[model samples]
Structure formats: C-alpha cells, structure tokens
Target chain A: MNTVFFLVFGLIVVVCAINVVVQRHPISSAISLIGVMGSLAIIYLQLGAEFMAAAQIIVYTGAVMVLFIFVIMLLNAGSEEGGKGPLTVRLLGVPLLLVFLGLLSYLIQRLFSDTGPVRFGDFKGGSPADVGRALFSTYLLPFEITSVLILIAILGAIVLARKELD
Target chain B: MPAAVPLSWYLVLSAVLFSLGVAGFFFRRNIITMFMSIELMLNAVNLSFVAFSFQLKQVSGNIFAFFVMVVAAAEAAVGLAIILTVFKNRATLNVDRIDSMKY
Candidate 1:
C-alpha cells in the first residue's frame, strides 16, 4: 500500500518536473514547479518526517516559488516563441544526457557491488533535538561558514542588481 | 500491511528528479526557469539525504535539510532581486541576451 502511495506521488512529481522544463511560458512552468514541490512534501509526509514535509511546502512551495512568480510577473517576461535556439539546445543535450546516464548507471552498480549495505549506525532515532545538537556542536563551523556564504551571496546580488544612477 | 518498500526506491526517485532538474538547467532559456531548475536539483538531493538519514535512523539529514532551507531562502531572495534588476534595465530576462558584463 505504501509502495503504491510513493510510486503514484513520485510519478506525479516526475510529470510536473518535466512540465517545468517543457512549458513555453514561465508562469506555467512556475505552476508546474509548485505542483512538483507540493507532491514532494507529500512524499516526505508518507516517509514519517512531518517537519520536513511542512518545511518542504512552506519554504520551497510557499515562499520561494511565490518569489519566483513575482519576479516573472514584474519582469513581464513574454512566452518564448518557438525558436531555432531552443531546438538546437535540445538536440545538443540529448547525446550528452545519454552519456551521463550511462556513466551514472555504471557508478551506481559499482558502489552497490563494493560497499554492500551502508552502515548507518549513528543515524537511528533522528529527531529535531538531535539535529539542533549536531548543528551547534559537531557541525557548528560548517553551519557558521554557510551563514557567511549566504551573506556574501546577498551582498553580491545587491551589487549586481543595483542600477547605475545617471 | 503490505510488502515493505526498500530505501532504494526513495534514492531512485531522488536520482530521477535530480536528472530532470539537470535537463531543465541545460534546456531552459529564461533565467528564472534556470534558477527554478537549480532549486529543483537542490531539493532532489535533499530528498536523497533525508532518505539515507531515515534508513540509517539518524538526525543528520534533518539538520542538513534545515541548512538547505536557509541556503534556498538566500538564493530566492538574491536571485529574484537580480532577476528584477535585470528586467528593469534590459526590459528582457532571457539568459542568452544578458552578456553585457562579458568582455
């Protein structure tokens, strides 16, 4: 029953994700992206991670996607007309994708054959409390560095976006 | 109640989603769509991380997901701001045409 549940939602996410790329209009792509993220949140719920599922919906689908849509609207970006460039891009991508797929398949087979089952000894009973401790303790430096990186990205984005005053 | 699903199922789904995101990143022309594609890729990886954490019964995945959320937030704010500015100046947001900064 649960397998069926995951399979169905997973298929839906795949379809919507493809739509995110195939749609000609940016708004439609955003809509499809929302659908994809929402389904992913549902998958997280079925996996027994309520907090993650909520964050999936609230952060990505709710906040980030809305921001994307707002930018699209503000830009008034018109639907891309059928054009030669996109077609050429697609044509070039196909073979490269095939090569990557082959390489990834080989790597997966190699990893499983060599490693047997992964050892997850320390990962059991995962909880928000555990996450909090790990973040502030073992992973503290990485966390702080990531914060600094985000700050730099914000500052850089502002610099890039600022209009030159005449 | 039924046959148990293996952890590999979730991993496979994540891989598929990640690949689709990659395809979108390469194929899409609009900058916003490209950014959305990047977000998709990030979320797909997060799914795999959470799945592995679940299978291992650890909290590291949850913590990583939290960090990913922070980065995604920052990316959204900065990325959208840049997009808005590009549109205001160029009056277009197509990725191919924004080569003004290039020498």
Candidate 2:
C-alpha cells in the first residue's frame, strides 16, 4: 500500500523535477518546480511529517513560487536562446543519465532490501504540536534568528529591486 | 495492512531529485534557472532529512529540515535581489553574457 503511494508521488516528483531543469522558459520551470513541491508535500505527509507537508505546500508552492513568477514577469525574461551547448553533449547526456539512474536504483535496492519495509504509520512524531513545542523550546534561538534573517532579506530585496531615485 | 515501501526507495528518490538539480545547475544558461536548480537541490535534501527523521524516530531531523527551508528562503530573496542589481548594470540574465567581472 505504501509502496504504491511512494511510487505515484515519487514518479511525479521526478518528472516535474526534470521539467524544471529542461524547460527553457523561466516561467515554465517555475510552474514545474511548483509541481515538484506539491508532490513532495504528499510524500512528506506519507512519511508522517504533516506539518512539514503543510509548510511545504504553503511556503514552497504558494509563497516561493509566487515570488518566482513575480520576478519572471517583472524581468520579462523570455525563453532562453536555443542550442545551449554542443550537440554531442546533449545527445550523449540522456543515455548516460539513464544508465546512472538504473545503476543507482539497483545499488539502493541491493543495500536496503534487508532494512525492512516502511509502513504508513511507522513513526508519528512529526505533528504540528510536537514541532511547535520543539520550535519554541529547544529550537527557540534558531527560530528567532530566522525571523531576523527574513527581515534582512526583505530589506535587501526592496533596496535592490526598487527603482533608483537618482 | 499491506506491504510498505522500503525505506531505501525514499532515499533513492531523493538522490534522483538531487542529481536532476545538479544537472540543471550545470546545464542551464539562465541565472534564474540556475538558482531554481539550487532550490531543487535544497528541496531534495529536505526530503532526505524528513525520511531520515522517520527512520530515526526523532524530531530533530525535521527541525533540521525546517532550518534548511529558512536558509533557502533567505538565500532566494538575497540572490534575486543581487540578480536584479546585476541585470540593472549588465542588461542581461545570461550567465555567460554577464562577464564584466571576469579578468
């Protein structure tokens, strides 16, 4: 059951990830990355990280992707120029990547076959309440630091992106 | 209950995504695309972290993953700002074309 779950979302993530890399247009890549984020959120939920799943959707797909799209539109960056690199490199790279993936999957299966299966309800320690408690307690310092960092980022982005007065 | 997926499968998926990110970073010519690739790589690592959190039955892995997200968000904001500045000066987004800094 869980294998089927992973297989579906995993395939979606891989394909969309490839799309993000292969698309010439930045907008298209941004959309594909949003797809990747959605699927990864599903996988995160399957792994019992419910809060992370929600955060992944809300942050990565919703906020970050919107930011990307806004930048793309603002910049008016059309599709990339064609013929990015040599024909030989493009022709041979696909097959080489296939072989690499095949080898990696084989090795991973061989190594983890005996590590037992991962059922849906394996470890349920990733709830929001748990994460919140941890965030405010053990990880409090980092949380505060991150807030400060975000403020700095906002300031820097505004300063750099705004039109010059002079 | 039905048979579950192996833990390794999740790890393998993460590895595959990370490889694609690396490929994008290397193959793409656009600066924004390259930055997107880096985000993809960060996401792949986040998946791995959550997977390991499940494996170890600990909350710390998720904590680490959260921190990674925070860092990535910060990086993206600052990076895009810098990109904006570069575009203002150079009038292009192509990595190869932005060669004024070269020796």
Candidate 3:
C-alpha cells in the first residue's frame, strides 16, 4: 500500500514536473507546477514531515502558485515557439534530458539498494506541536527574521510594481 | 503489506526534479517560466532536506527546508515585481528581447 501510494504520487509529480518544463504557455506550465506541488505534499506526508507537508500545500501551492498565475494573466504572456534561443537548447535538450535522467536513475538504484525502505508509522515526531516547539525555541531568531524579510519583500514588490504617477 | 520505498528512491526523485528544473531554467524563453523553474529547483532541494531529516531522525533538515520555502516566497515576489517593471518599460516578456543590459 505504501509503495503503491508512493508510486502514484511520484508519477504525478514527475509527469507534472515535466509538463511544467515542456508546456508552451506559461499559464499551462503554472497550472502543471501546482499539480506537482499537490502531489509533493502527499509525498511529504508519506515521509512523516507533516508540518512541511501542510506548508507545502498552504504556503507554496496556495499563495505562491496563485501569485504566479496572477502574473501570467496580468502580463498577457503567450506561448513561445523557438524564441531565438541557443541552438543546443532548441534542438538537443529534450532527448539529452531523457538520457541523462535514465543514467541517473540507474546510478541511484545501483548505489543504495541495501538501506531499509521507508515505512509509514516509523516516524512520529513530525507533529505540528513539535515543529512549533522547535520554531519557538531553538529557531526563534531565524523565525522572527523571516517575518521581517517577508515584510521587506512585500514593500519592495509594491514599490516596483506600482504605476508611475505624473 | 506493501513494500517500503527505499530512501534512495526519494533522493533519486529529488535529483530528477532538480535536473528538470535546471532544464527548464536553461530552455524556457519567458522570464516567468524560468522563474517557475527556479521554484522547482527550490522544491527539489526542500525534498532532499526532508528526506535526509527522515533518515537522520533530526528536525534540523525540516527547519532548513522551511527556511528555503520562506526565502523562495520572497524571491518570487521581488522577481515578479521586477518582471512587471520590465514589462511596463519594454513591453515584452521574452528573455531574448530584454537585452538592454548587454552592451
């Protein structure tokens, strides 16, 4: 059951990830990346990073992806077709990518076949409470700093994107 | 009674995703799509962190991944804003056309 779920979600992630790269329209790619994030959230759950899984869905898929789609719509970006890129990327990239991935998979399978496989219920410490405790205790400073950083980002984005007034 | 997926499988998945992100970053023509590829690379690294955290039984990796996500959000905001400014000035999103700095 665990393997089956992993296979399904992993397949979804891989397919959507490829679609994210290969799609002609930025909007289509944006939507496909959302699919990747959704499936990745499930993979995170399986790995016992419950808090990260939730964050993946909420922060990443929800806020970040929405921001991406908004930009895509606002810009009125269209599908690109061989838009004067280097000849290598325009011609050889796709096939080379496939072969490179095949080699990588083969290498990884060869290297780590002895370790124990991932099993659910093996990890129990990924609860929200545990993450909160760590966040407030050991990582308190970085957490606070991140909030300030987010504030700065918001201000900068607003400043840069606002219209010029005469 | 399904078999457990090996730890290497997850790591391998991360590797593949990262490579795909790199491919997109190199191949795409639009700036937004390239930015999405950067996001993909970040996500792949986050996955690697979480997988290692599971392997080592430490929460530190998860914390790092969380930080990466936060930084990525900031990057996306500033980046998209810059893209908007560029579009307003130049009226084009194709990366090849925005080479005013290439003097």
Candidate 4:
C-alpha cells in the first residue's frame, strides 16, 4: 500500500516537474511547478511530518509559486518564436547531458545499493510538537538566520521589481 | 495494516527526480524552467531527507526539511525577481542573449 502511494505521488511530481520544463510559456510552467510542489507536500504528509507538509504547501505552493507567477505576469515574459532557438547551439548541450546522465545513474546506484533494511516504522512519540521543540531548541540559530535571510530576500526582490524610486 | 515500504524506494524515487531536474537544468533554454528545475532538485533532496529521517527514527530530518522549504521560498522569490528585472532591461529572457554580466 505504501509503495503504491509513494509511486503514484512520485509519478505525479515527476510528470508535473517535466511539464514545468517543457512548457514554453512562463505562466504555464509556473503552474506546472505548483503541481509538482503540491505533490511533494502530499508525500511529506504521508511521511507523517504534518507540520513540514503544511509548511511545504503554504510556503512553496501558496507563497513562492504565486510570486513566480506574479513576476511572469507583471513582466509579460515570453520567448521569441515561442521557444525556438538555434538548433546547433541548443544541441551543443547534448554531450554534456549524456555525461550528466551517466554520473546520475552511478550516484543513484552507489547510494541506494548499500542500504540496510528499509526502516518503515513511525517515531515513537515524535509529532509536530517535537518539530517545534527542535526548531526552537537545538536548531534555533539556523532557524533565526533563515528568517533573516528570507527578510533580505523579500526586500531585495521588491527592490529589483520596483520600476522607480519616485 | 498499512503496508511498509522500504527506504530505498524513497531514495530511488528521489534520485530519479533529481536526475530529471538535472536534465531540465542543463537542457532547457528558458530561465523559468531552469528555476523550476532547481525547485525539483530541492524537492528531491527533501525526499531523501524525509526518508533518512524515517530510517533514523529522528525528528531532526523534518527540521531540516522545514529549513529547506524556507530556503527554497527565498530562492524562488529572489531568483524570479532577478529574472523579471533582467527581462525588463533586455527585452528578452533567453539566458544566452542576456550576457551583460559576462566579464
């Protein structure tokens, strides 16, 4: 049952992610990326990290994807010739891509092959509460720094997007 | 009974997703798609984090996942904004054509 669910969710995410790349228009690509993120949040829920799942949906799907779409719409961003480019230049990446594919498969095999028994049980008492405790207690510094980083990002984005100071 | 799936399944799923992201990152011409590929890679890492968290029977992995989400959010906001600003100045978002930053 879990395997089936995992496969389905993973398939959904992979498919949408590919669509995000293949879609010519930026707006549609953003939309497809939202679907990918949404499926990932669902996978998080299945892992029993409820708070993480919620945060994934709220932050990635709700906040970030919308921001991406908004920027696309505001700029009216589009590709010349609906995404056509010089075939020679584009195909120049083919050999590099083949190299990447080789490296990826090697890494995947090396990582997953030596694994022991797949532990498929739940944490005895871990819950969202435990997550909060860890966030504030052990990982507090990084947590605080991440907030500051986000603030800087927001300000920087606004500054970049703003047309004029006056 | 809720069937138990192995950790390798998640790990393998993540690897596949990550590879797809890599392909998109290199092959795609559009900056937006490239950003989406980055997001895909991040989610792939999150999958591995969750799987390892479950394997280790610890809550720390979830914590890391949260942090990754925060960073991803910030990245999306800043990256997309930069793409937009670049488009405004150059009139096209093709990364090849926009080489103003090249030294």
Give per-residue CA lDDT, model 2, range A32-111, as digits (tens): 99999999999999988988999898888888888888888888999987636667767877777778778888887887
Report each candidate's C-alpha RMSD, comma-separated, in the order given: 3.7, 2.3, 1.9, 3.0
Error of 4 at A5 (Å): 0.8
Screening candidate 1 with a backbone cut-off below 3 angstroms (N, C-alpha, C), the clashing residue pairs are A123-B57, A123-B58, A124-B57, A124-B58
lDDT tens string, model 1, A88-110?
A: 66687868876775666566556
After superposing candidate 3, which stretches have Cα over 4 Å from the reference? A91-111
Worst 10 residues of 2 chain B by lDDT: B1-10
Task: Tell me which residue pairs clash in candidate 3.
Answer: none
Across residues A1-166, which tens digit of lDDT does each residue of candidate 3 receive?
8899988999999999999999999999999999999999898898889999999999999999999999989988988857667787778987888888788878877876676888886776677888888889999999999999999999999999998899
In model 4, where do residues sit more than 4 Å from their true spots? Answer: A79-111, A114-121, A124-126, B1-3
User: Which residue pairs in model 2 clash with each other?
Assistant: none
lDDT of 4 by residue, A22-89 (tens): 77777877888888888888877777677877888888888888887877787777752445557874
TM-score of every candidate: 0.83, 0.91, 0.93, 0.86
TM-score of chain A of 3: 0.88
Better of 3 and 4 by TM-score: 3
Ordered list by TM-score, greatest first: 3, 2, 4, 1
Which parts of model 2 have CA positions greater than 4 angstroms off?
A: A86-113
